[model samples]
Target chain A: MSKPVSKFYLGVDIGSLTTKVVMVDEESRIIARATGRTGFSGREVASRLAASLLIELQLSEKDVAATVATGYGRVTFPADREMSEITCQARGIYQLFNKAETVIDIGGQDSKVIKVLPGGKVSDFTMNDKCAAGTGRFLEVMAGALEVDVKELGGLAEEASDSCSISSICTVFAESEVISHIAAGRTKPDIVAGVCNSVAARVAALTARTGLAPDVVFTGGVARNKGVVNALAAQLGTRLLIPDEPEITAALGAALFARDIAPKNKPCV
Target chain B: MAEQRRYRPLASTRQLEKTMTRYYALTRYHRLWGRPLRRPLAWVTSGAPVELLLAFNIHPVYPENYGAICGTRKVSAKLCKVAEAAGYSQDLCSYARSHIGSIMRPDLAPMGGLPRPDLLVACNNICGTVLKWYEALARIFNVPLLVLDTPYLPGEVTGHAVGYVHEQLKEMAADLEKITGRRFDARGLEKRLLLSKETISLWREIREFCRAEPSPLNAPDLFIHMAPIVVLRGTKQSLKYYRQLRDEVKHRVDQGLGAVENEKIRLVWDNIAIWYRLFAFFKDFSQRGACFVTDTYSGGWAVELSPGDPLESLASTYTEIFLNRSLEFRARQMIDLIKDFNAHGFVMHSNRSCKPYSLVQEVIRRQVMRETGVPGLMVEADMADSRVFANEPVKNRVQAFIETLEA
Candidate 1:
């Protein structure tokens, strides 16, 4: 059904809220990519996604020379090696934009600011593990509070005439702030814009903890939201270089690592 | 998973367990013989001057150490909840919360809660929380609470600061004399101070053994083995335990054995051990060939006794602990440990309970990294509370930190 493949690499990133899988050729070309909601079990979802993804390319698991897993569920997923999302993000960003000196990744439950050394090594990183204030989960809660779809938040925010102040960085507290804003007759566009600006402000503080260096790359699910992208850019006073597919960059990076480790396993030609 | 995970524990843990068990057992049943022996048990903070308690023949018990026991036993959440339900805010120190919860509900605490105290000594050297915590204890027990106000030293330990603490010591000694019906003798404290000095020196020597290429001991070893040092610091039992520990550590260093199976990377640890997940947490590092060669926490007990007579030295020693020092001193301490231990990196636990230790850690981490040119990572968690430690998230951070170090 498809061209015969000699060697291919697989990468799986089973994050908290989503599962992504990518297949790459010997030249690191992305052969196929798939993503899903990662519902109950990331491991099962990852395995199923990989199975269906392989069939789409008419490739079997045997064609995969190596596998590397990265993310919250990476340890449970069967792979040749497990890497941290930070390392994989840096790798993916470096490969796409070689000049990226900093990476700000806002995932489902946590946000991180990574300082990348030459060649994509993570020289320093600071993550907000204490709370979910500056993450996608925070946005999800705010959207639910406003009775708006999370995807529509960006479009709605772009129409705001005035930005209502969401004073609290706490998800629960900020939800109340949004309710008060709604009760005070604030517009939906204004409230949604305030929510995005709040996330940007929280993330901006994290960058201060780890000094922001330029040619910055923003990755992860939240990077898909253009509202946050614009707000974060304005907050940090720098332009962000976003990949074509932000959510799958970590999976691509893991696949790149799988490529690097492929030669040690049988011939990766 | 049903089978419990076993670690390569130090050879001296048997002695450590025996010493600690006996100490707890004795403290547990102190009500049986304490009054008859005229040795009133005094509940004290971790940084309290215990040698003076010994001089007065007063048995001292540590609630902070018992909080650690509750944490390691995995009952801190149950205990802490009891305290929180009783109006103690969840924001309070987990140690204080769990300990106070034990007071409200001893059935949930280890050793059925520390033996009831006849007096309480609250020292502010370690943290300001102890003052309020001990005052509450005094209220609950209706015992005479002795407060030792150690001035915060933004720089070196000043004569004025030491004098201020020395006056509180005199007042404390007088209070002890009235309670124990005995005269306070500066000369009588000599033997206790000597034993404490010798035990601390032995601990220092044992820590120095970790300077070896493949560190003979990891931070967990130091944490587990330092129990006697905390509870039985100024006694023959503690002295005996450290002697065994020192020799075993020396033997490992001589034979080129490492606590971590493959010690490829060496790290210096900051802050208290995550007691509830101690083994499970450190295993993440050790399995990755990262051995915590040294740490700032257990070494808190190994501080040198200041040069002075017993009282003056006690004033300075207790006042100058790492937790009491300035940010510059703390950053310098980490930098020195990194250099002296030849560590690849350092990790600071942004402990939710320890405000003093965790507050300035970011600044200190930045300073340490700048001075040493090595990366430092901070993990957010509570030392004793399980509710705050998100397992998957913590694992993610540790894995990333280990990868950075490996690269």
Candidate 2:
């Protein structure tokens, strides 16, 4: 029996707040994924990520036939192909949940909701770039104020009985509101749930404007939170589909896009 | 002629300057001035043809025009209240608030429904906010909208862009023709072009008069004069009006009248005018005897490529505008304004709602101040959304700013 041919492709997502990297085999299976805070040097971070991932996977650099970059810093990355995060995320979500009609991506610093048509075209989208209220940063700040680890806050929020209502849309004011709620003897679980609900409400309002469609998938770092996912699903009046690793969608999409452009590597075909 | 009587010209520079000073003194800060256009008003705004509505024989109302009115009337706060009530945060643009206020309040306009637009055209050229603003109105009023996509003409206005804009203009004219059931006569276009050029020439003369040591007109009065250009563009009446305005300004210059009540420092205004806060901004600068001797808005008129070449020049102007151009062009434009005005310092309003205008303002401000020795200050605010207007902070900054300029 002959051994099957093996090939590797790389995807890089250089965003405003985080640098996400992903590697995939010929069949679009995720071989490895890594993320780091975007330091002052974007190029250096990208090169280091590529090297680390290659070393960890025990794959030589020569095995990677094509590399694609996406995100705001997509063009900044030294790669064979550069694609917009919009196209990459849309492609990524479509690959995972073929029935997903909408993709809501909430990242470290910003949030965007993209509506995908049946044919995989982005029909409409809304992005909240002007403010930091409806983003992962908001959740991080709320978690710090509540004196809870961010990773565990989701489960705590899910256990809350009565979530307090947060009225302030400004993140700064919202933080103060959370502190006041705590001072007023609100439960930690309830306040945590409230913070998640506030973010969900803002995202829902934005997504509602574009008219939400079903089989909605939440992609990005914020999607990992159970409380936010529950509130968003309730607000959207639909089940929220989340991938096993939501944040790696853009990078995976970039890799898939790279494979499409470089067809001679029939191993993935 | 009855309507024309109300449009009385600003008779003298002293009178214009005095009115400006008084208005600024009274209009403490930029705030909203009217009620939000309710569903009915939205119907009025989005319903008919904007051109025909302006011809309403009624005074056409532009939110921008009303912002100027609020500035001149010195009562923008009342209008701003409407937007604040709707949970629009203070960080939104003041001008947007003023318009929203005007729309919400029917009582603000006493002259039988403030000449609402039969049609409203909001383009993405100036800012992306306008598209959303009109979209909200469209849902409320159900009016047909015409979107003119002048895609960020990548580089300088080239022949290809000129051709593209001309094609859009031709299509627009055809649409108008279909709506109005009237063909666009070439002769009429010629006549309109001639009047537009003549009005532009007179407006230029008025701007030129500002070069005098003590500029004859203040920013507030100049804000009022902006009406004819914006509303009556391409009309003989507009040309005649500007001629009178230029003559009045020229007379003031000859008499050595200062733009402010008292002659003081000359300052250059950077960025688009804070439409909602026009009075407050003008008052803040002028009260300290700081005359806005030049502005980026006024510099746009210098691109007159001629009457026959208007289609091309107009296209060029659209593509080459400060908002539409690359960062380098904007930096150069600021440098030129600073030098041309021989300004002592500059005020760059880092407007939050306008990203295209505000994105590289910090970079330009630093570079120009370094090169020209003109100190540049960035005042944070929204151009239209009144919710973002923090009077105390702005006032405190202005006071400190004047002292720095004096020093």
Candidate 3:
């Protein structure tokens, strides 16, 4: 008799700027993944990524048992189910670390601090309100002003002997501050470090409002910035558990949910 | 953006608009009729003793209501900026800021701003901000400002607190007598108080009708219909309006009509309504089968009048409002609402303009969740300023909350 073919579940996170897809088998192990820019058409990007991921995994569309979509652009992407990034992030981090008490997710346009209770449920949460001052967009803007790639910001900041202080709490005003710093002949690395510090400070305030707890997990595109990671660690006064692929954490969580919600299992409402 | 479709507006909205337009017209053209009718216009806070002012035959105009009108007209941001330019901090209450801005530039205001007040009545039962706001108005308008300070009740209303408020009411009566050149008539005051009590009872009944399955009224309906209750509290007009509203709501309940099409999740709202996006904001929830059956903001006027001396009762009734109490009291009040309304969850607006109402909300959320075992969602936005609303984040949070409830 032939062995049974393994069933795979798909999860897609169509964020404002990026679309991520992850495929996990019945055992909840990620088997394939893909990421792409979500431009103005998140549904198109999600479908293209999903097709590419299926090809890379040598699977047909029918091979996927279930699919779940998450993030800001979730509603645009058709899936078997839709979930919010808050729940997906909490679920993903808890699955990876098994002890994640707090999660500080800094996305492209927003930041959120979620308190994770036992069993991967969100106990409480708070998001950055109506501003992009402490998010990945902030870093991208500062990088553009400093004439450096966003990925280079962390390394450059790490090389700085001292960091400048960014006093403005607003993104637009802070960009002006950066321009003034550049005009005043401040070191690029120092200015970059200052930007990182400001982002960390803003995120720390958000986490504090949600009552930050131990075993903090950092996720999202901003988690890749080493300078921000270091500054956030210092501000929070604790180490962070960053997933191997920070950007795919929410997608992985969605896949996990899909696995549990496949045809044989009772469906999630 | 997709083509925005207007939801079905309340039937009472036409009547409300007509009544309010006539009222405003009367105030605008008061000079033509004031001398013969012997009516004076006084600007009163939402929590002020409007019944007493009515007894003195003074036309009571509510700045807060006009602030809401400005909010609905979507001019609050511009008005608020004007106030900010005039040196008021942006952190101050947006309603106060917008109202002040309207006064400074009446040409830019709706209806050339509320007609000038002969007297300003400020009550601190709602928030201390009113005292400062009315004081600023008094300074600018140069009118007498009567402050009725209602001490914050950490627990139940105390005799000392009631006594203090009673003394102020007496002094206010004397002041009204001096302004109107008439003796303070206890009979008139009692009659007005009785009418106010009946009006409050009718308002309460209208809100209670929301407890019906597939609630007869939504948050905005309650908000719109409560206008008369706020501005015409001691009049036959308010009682008449609420009676019509109560019957309409009762008929909706009988016919098994819901505020939202398929009302699956009933929610209790905390804090003030986002007046700028009232219909659009609630559309997102209603589309998902979630309905806001009741809210703490408009329900502030639904309390039963304490049985005692008229002034003493007014003192206790106004001072014991939900906003004037401690966080514990507010939490319990929310819990009772959730239970009484049979709500599946609650949504709290962490409003930026109203600090007293927004602050301590996290604590209250925790307490209510612990007591009720139902989830609570917090959306941080300004009540009046659309600039402070983050659409995607709020959508994500609300969607996630509804998902949790569904699970």
Q: Please, what is the TM-score per model?
A: 0.97, 0.52, 0.89
Two-chain complex of model 3, DockQ on C-alpha atoms against the true structure: 0.49
Q: How many backbone clashes can be found in candidate 1?
A: 0
Better of 1 and 2 by DockQ: 1
Which is the leading candidate under lDDT?
1
What interface root-mean-square deviation (Å) does model 1 yield?
0.9
| Models ranked on DockQ | 1, 3, 2
- Residue-level lDDT of model 3, residues A234-261, one tens digit each, is 9999999899999999999999999888
lDDT of 2 by residue, B182-248 (tens): 5666555555556656776777778878878887765556655655665555555566667767777
Output candidate 2 Cα RMSD.
20.5
- In the range A1-269, model 1's lDDT, one tens digit per residue, is 54554788899999989999999888888889999988889999999999998889887677788999998889899999999999998888888888999999999987999999989899999888678899999999999999999999999989999999989878999999999999999999999999999999999999998898889999998998988999999999999998889999899999999999886547422
TM-score of chain A taken by itself, candidate 1: 0.96
Displacement of the residue B28 alpha carbon in candidate 2, Å:
29
Error of 3 at A214 (Å): 5.0
Q: What's chain A's TM-score in each predicted model?
A: 0.96, 0.92, 0.96
Better of 2 and 3 by TM-score: 3
Model 3 per-residue lDDT tens digits across residues B1-407: 99544344568777788877878888899888876887888999999988788889999899888888888888888899899999999999888988999998888888988888988999998888998999899999888999999999999889999999999999999999998877888788889888888988888888888999889888878877888888888888878777877788788888988877778899999998899988878887887888889999998988888878888888888888888899889999999999999999999999999988999998899889889988898999888877788777888888878777765
Report clash pairs, candidate 3. none
Q: How well is candidate 1 docked (DockQ)?
A: 0.82
